[model samples]
Target: MNTNNKRIKKGKVKKKKRIRISRLILVLVVLLVIFAGAGNLYYKSASKAVNDKSTKSVLIEVPNGSSVKKVAKILKEKDLIKNKSVFISNVKGNEKAKHLKAGKYKLAQNMDNNAIIEKLIKGEVYQDGVKLTIPEGMLSTEIVNKLVSQKFGDREKFVKLYRSPKEFSSKFSFLKDSRISTLEGFLFPSTYYIKKGETEKQIFEKMLLEFQKEYDKKVKSLVEKNKLNLYDTVIMASIVEKEAVNDSDRDIVAGIFYNRLDKKMKLQSDAVLQYGLPERKSRVLYSDLKVETPYNLYLHEGLPPTPIASPGIKSLIAAANPKKTDYLYFVTNVDGKNSYSTTFEEHSKNAKKYHQERNDLLKENSSEKNKTGNDENDNKEKSKEKTTN
Candidate 1:
């Protein structure tokens, strides 16, 4: 009876152990399932696009020496990535991430991380057209040089085309003005994406079209209301673009020029004098102002015969609608800030103050340079003395 009872007890113990093992196995299986689902959800979220339905192309430039983290930040900022951490992890995991090139890339919002990484690694940069960025206040000759350097057209052909606005007058009505001889200010300074096989003439036409659009949008109504022709307004805008250092200053400078114009006072713009010179210098000498040219505002009473350089849209708007002020004269300081004055005596005082400040700055710079040279010589002498000793 005792042996049978002991056997029953052992059998019961074995059954309990089996049941506990089964429960442990079941718990582990459930945990595995939960973990698998969570991992799958994370993968789906990471792999998906920020906007799968949108087809808008965004241009992003990955500058030289940019790391994976920097590129990820750029993508995140551009709203091209769903998660920056996922992007970085994916990039680090991919062997091709090391091969990513620096350039302007045209990426779409529909692209996933894998697609973007592949594109960047393969260096599939935007090459749909030639990029031509003509900055504001560039002289026509400078523009011609830029085009020639880029192998856009022959120098002589570009120069000839630039001088003859009549060539493009048939297409652009703004060029119909009898006074419009050169296409200086009419080139419209802006970034242009020229087609692969476009000619110089077509390029010029594109710029002129842009100019027309901008002028009509921003300056046309104002010019018409002010009883100013497009030619004169563009000329003034060109001058304003060259003179003013900032936007607020642009309007005020335009006003000063208008005031001078109304009073029949000479514009006396150093920029105009510099424009008429054969070559541009860092500093325009007093003698340069005395040189006889239509563009020399000091010598000439009115606007230059042609616009000095390509006037940007802001300058164009400022010229059309100048800020009303009693200021007739302005003198720029060493830091590009202008001091405005309503009387000649006030203008003279401001000019003297700026001139003295500039002179003092120059002397200080010269003194620093001399001290540097003396220190270098002293170091050399000390080295020689030490070697001899």
Candidate 2:
């Protein structure tokens, strides 16, 4: 009876052990299947197009300082990526994605993660154009120099295009004025993306078009109501652009210039004198003021024949609507602040103070330079004596 009972118990234990092993195998198989499905899904998502149904090209600007995380967010925002985490993880896993270059890339939504990473790494900037930035108060020569530096074109060719803008003069109404010799003020200082193989003429036309767009109906009405011509307005604006470093002071400087013009007084602006020179100087000397060019406000009255530099919209608006002030004279201080006065005596005093301060700075700089030269000479002499010994 006891043997039979023990055998029954052993049989039950064996059955229970087998059942547990079977259940464990079943669970393992289920887990493997789930993992395989998940792996397959991830692989498909990473390898396939972000949106195979849509084919829209978007301009993606990767600025100077962009991180992978930031780029992933940008891509997500542009609908170029379905999942940010997946894209980021894929990029982090890849070796080539680490060397992404900064540029304006033309990306399409149909591109996959791997394709986009490859494009970024290769820096294959879709060649729509290169960007050129021209700041306000930049002269034609300065613009040409910038173009040359950027390898846009030859300097001589660009200068020729600037000097003789024959085609543009006829095509555009604002340029039809015969006195408009050069496209100095009309270049419209702003950022421009010029297409590859575009001529200097085409680029200038684009800039002029931008200027025309900015000078809308309201601005034109302002010019008409102010009893001012476009050419003169641009000229005054150019002077104002060079004169006023501060935005708030632009209107005041414009007012002062208008007052001088109204009184038939010579607009003795140092900027105008600098414009007359072939090479602009750091400082306008007493002798430089004596230059007898048409652009020289010191030697002649009224506005210059042409705009000295490109004037931004603020300067243009200031010229169109000058502040109502009796102040006729203005001088820039050593700290680059402008002091305005109605009386000549006050103007002279301000000018004297700034000029003396400037002269002192100049003398101090010269003394430092001399000391450096002397130190260099002494070192050389000591070296020579040591060598001789």
Candidate maximizing lDDT: 1
Writing each residue's lDDT as its tens digit, candidate 1 over 1-389 gives 69999999999999999999999999999999999999879977876788999999999999989998899999999999988888888888898687579989999889999999999999888866789999999999899999999988889888999989999999999888888888989999998887777888988998999999899888999999989888999999999999999887999999999998999988887788788899987666545655898888766798888899999999999999999999988888898899998987787778768766765675678775564543444443432322221
Best by TM-score: 1
For each candidate, the alpha-carbon lDDT, in order, equals 0.86, 0.81
Candidate 1: residue 381 Cα off by (Å):
42
Model 2, span 41-99: residue lDDT tens: 98767656777877789989887678888888888898887777778877888977766
In model 2, which range of ten residues has the least summed lDDT? 380-389
Q: Tell me which residue pairs clash in candidate 2.
A: none
